[model samples]
Target: MRNKPPYALSSVDHALHLAALLQQEGPMRVTDAAERLGVAVSTAHRLLAMLVYRDFAEQGPDRRYRPGKVLRPAAASAAPVALLRELCLPELRTLMERTQESANLMVPAGAEVRFIATAESPQVLRGGDRVGRSLPAHCVSGGKTILAALPPTELDALYSEDDSVDLPRLRRELALVRERGFAINDQLTETGLTAVGMAIKDAGGSPVAALSLALPTARFDRERLPGWVGALSSAVAKVEAALSAR
Candidate 1:
């Protein structure tokens, strides 16, 4: 038979490829979708944005895109802990590599945040691993990020009748977090430990998790604050992407 060239529209092909991914996976980020389709981030972003506009896909609070009502989710499911731990380990590793600091994943439990995964830095003076530990959600960076993503009524309920916390002050802090898009802990949880974090959301757009970087006070450079925030944000995005796959 005579040879014939295959017909393809690159843009449409990429969009259909992304739709297939959304059907097979749960959610995905622009970077991930771009890498998967071998395209630029801007191209992938535009495609996903168009999908959102057409109601073929939806963007979650974490800024990841998932299959919209036009598509059905995969049926596979796993225990929450198992799925979370698996999803976060690589993200924590990525955060550690980016910041050379301890990286931790946390999930909210009522008024507390439980450490679900931890990747500690190699430096001798680095912050310790906090896996399997729990702390008040309103105190640490990760926990505060999660709390700040909550509804006003839920937040008010969380702090009501708590004598140890200054509700007004906490509210102001959360307001600042929403404005800044990330949370910071300047030795608030521990005397010499500092951290920055961003909230992680599920396909439904609820802040179910947080990704954070823990740094020793002496090594936490204020000049590099923006870089650190970027790392944390990237980590959360990757985590959301991975979670979608599961």
Candidate 2:
């Protein structure tokens, strides 16, 4: 039998319990979750909201919470992910310092991308830390950058399985990304947020992750895009070199 820690945090325990419920029991209403967890409805809502934000749970069309992608079984191991974050954080911090914008490191997860680390900008109006967040691959700058680096057959196979994706349109955008050697997401992932991204290649020239600079759309001057791309390229180079050395 597993023993609970003496100093167990009630909030954390509640959230984990909620995640277990969602993963094992499938979708549930807020009221039902509150009853099952023996917490107030408002507390349950807050807990579910946190889960949604972390990609552990998602609210469905019927307003019921269901297990999200993070809860699904995956072949990827956590060790490499942790190492990737460790290797790239310094560069992310440097990029943030140089660009004065939030820098993020992300890796593709099927049709979506997961932000593993972030160096939040010190600016008053800037994108906040988004670690653990997941977004559609075809929508975000980093996602597109990584996708563009994918082999043609792999890219085609990936999008072919998803009916919702417009493969042709995505291919056209990716063509532009390939031509420019960078991708730009202009208020595509979130309103008022824009990001520039470049791929981080491994020793064999395969892209394993992407780096992005996210900022408020209002401050995303096209004239500054070249500078942002240059910063991201520099950060990616450092991260790639570290990965290669490792």
Candidate 3:
């Protein structure tokens, strides 16, 4: 019988290395994995597919891959989630105290935003924003901050041809956000609730999450929105810096 090629052994080694890297790092793309492994694109793609099939990794809507539940048992548990909580809690508390509004730390999950952590205000009319709640990505301030950070090509791919072709308007709005360093949703997600948000970029300047403050429209004065925006922006900067420094 013919001897098995050395490439097969190399492929197995590369896949194991990639899996270990994903467990250590956060989410990444196939190209990123290939670059890190110094392997061909096709090889990385195959490895990722196998990992996904075996439930060792999960693919996000943006095509990035993250470690799946199957890998959680062997890996150190609770550290990643605890790190997120520890980093976000103080900022969320500050935002709540400053604005007297609900504050949240949201991350992209598939096509929606998931509230990883939240701090509720003591106001009588506070909106109850709970953790683990998922919301449409296009309809919330936090979601908009994340969506606006995506490249034009990725943004275009997000919307369908039959859907509202409002690319020009969207681009203009995002440009304004780029200038202002934040995003706003005026009763977009729910009636009488307005939110202001800032994106949280990782060390590489990629938007990994967003932070936002939500208040009732009755108390959302246009004149006072700037102050809230500033508060949220400051909180976001501090959190991003802390995360990047780690």
Candidate 4:
């Protein structure tokens, strides 16, 4: 049999392919997608711009593309976290009211996590982390929680071969998170702070984000950790159920 050139896909087909790729692969830059798709830079940009304009994808602060709120309905029609923010807001607000600690919704973005939404507690001493801030995937509880939900192969691809703390360690920690059903970080990103996280899944049982509570280490004791974990777990479950119902 003679070898054949790769089949040339149409622009529409390419656009759809790009959307699916972004959805599966998480956030990526246009240049990276262009290189992977073997398309011209201009072609890739055009496709990405169209997706962004239609809200099928969102452009992050780092200029990478991720599945947008519009894609959520098709991806998992139940709960629609993007749309349910309104519903979640009340619960999140209540959480803040009770705990007086910062709460946030974190979505995975390649090797990083992006804060999609946040609620600040009214404590007089409270300072805030920006809503759109991006943090290293290995350093945050939310990042680890989402990472734990990925398959072993995907986890391996995320980390190094040696299983060292560099990349492999991240995979290993994620494995631990899967075992534990939650993740905790003690000042990994900053001093004197801690965070507890639980993964928020869609109706399809895919982890789309993490819900976390952040507090000061001085005030957050081992005795209180379970309560914090329970609160986060309850909130995540509520969000997951809401998504599933929708």
Candidate 5:
């Protein structure tokens, strides 16, 4: 075994030890984590939050940190992201077929949204497939949907972590999203693409993912935008239902 270096970061060491503890001992409380790592409760909370954000660990209903997909035995549990991608693909496919537009599944990754799955429109000229693309959360319709669901404290933390954002403007935008029950991108991320997005909540009603449909800007119409939004809403509900069943 390697010995600890003189300049090693204690925070990193604590996080690594906490990960090992979760794998061996199952779900754990903040107090337990703090005691195990010889750290403060606040530090343990922050470490666990980082793990949760990265899909390394998940917070249970009881506020305990469970052995996340990253620590699960390969033969015992399938990766949660992979399972979500598998379950969401059918819904994305259906959305693409029904709307004849590109559909995508996105999950937040800190300040950005990662596109995990996609179904391209069958049209010759349509949004191309983006199975592994990432974009700023504040700039995309799907990302906005996820951001709109973040609580005030979480939002504040996100803004604090990234100083480039205009907090007041983003607050206004997220408020609009909550009121509208979805988000719309009017060529915000790209010049010729307009997209509508809705959040996919988990059993606990947390916005764990988002669904979006991307259509060409030329084809966009204010009169028909509601219809597209309705389509996305229905698709999101279907995805939520599937997740609930799982």
Candidate 6:
């Protein structure tokens, strides 16, 4: 029988145990994680956040933790996630430079969107890098932009399985997003954050990901939104062109 080491770090042990639970037992809520690990809710949340940052876990639309890329079985082909991040970094940087706000590259993962790369603004009061973070598809600018591109039936089917969002409200917002060819999040995910996003489509005319610019809510100017969206759209176009070339 394997014995626990006397010097085993409890925090590391807890994180590993949590990862094991996600991999073997599937998705679990933070409360369930806390109960299983015998830790406080805040402690469990911190552990899960660390796992998410390391790609050992991801939070879904239902806000349950699940095994991430690092824990999942190997894919048949080269993982596109890495390639997308690499190819989009330059564009993200350009967008950040143009808008003076943080730029991010995200891809839809089921009913959630995962932040894979970020280029942070140099301003002292700017939005920070959000790489490795995940949020519900209906809650963030990039997620909404990606979702707005979905086929009507597919979009309806996706939210039908999850009851956390207001279907009618999301539908209305997505309709506006489609009309404008971009999406905006005004303190939707975090209280002080605002973001604008546009979809990046492949040569086949299918959206593969989204590019967004996030700023502090205090700095958001509706008067300047058109300029910001224009810059974001240009960056997306460049990224899409590169993807097509590849």
Measured over all alpha carbons after superposition, the RMSD of each candidate to the real structure, in angstroms, is 17.6, 2.3, 14.1, 11.5, 14.3, 6.3
In candidate 6, the residue pairs with backbone N, CA or C atoms under 3 Å apart (3 or more residues apart, or in different chains) clash, namely: none
In model 4, pairs of residues that clash are: 78-243, 78-246, 79-243
Off by over 4 Å in 1: 1-79
TM per candidate: 0.66, 0.89, 0.64, 0.63, 0.67, 0.72
lDDT of 6: 0.86
Q: Model 5 TM-score? A: 0.67
Model number with the top lDDT: 2
* lDDT, candidate 6, 179-207, per-residue tens: 99999889988899999988888788776
What TM-score would you give candidate 3 relative to the actual structure?
0.64
Candidate 3 segments whose C-alpha is farther than 4 A from its true place:
1-82, 161-165
lDDT at residue 201 of model 6 (Cα atoms): 80
Give the per-residue lDDT digits (tens) of candidate 5, residues 206-236: 7888889998898878898788788888888
Order of candidates by TM-score, top first?
Answer: 2, 6, 5, 1, 3, 4
TM-score, prediction 4: 0.63
Q: Output the number of the TM-score-best candidate.
A: 2
Backbone clashes under 3 angstroms, per model:
1, 0, 0, 3, 0, 0
lDDT: worst 10-residue window of model 4: 72-81
lDDT value, candidate 2, whole model = 0.88
Off by over 4 Å in 5: 1-79
> Given candidate 2, what's the lDDT at residue 69?
71
State each model's CA lDDT, in order.
0.82, 0.88, 0.79, 0.75, 0.83, 0.86
Worst-scoring 10-residue span by lDDT in model 6: 72-81
Residue ranges of candidate 6 with Cα displaced over 4 Å = 1-79
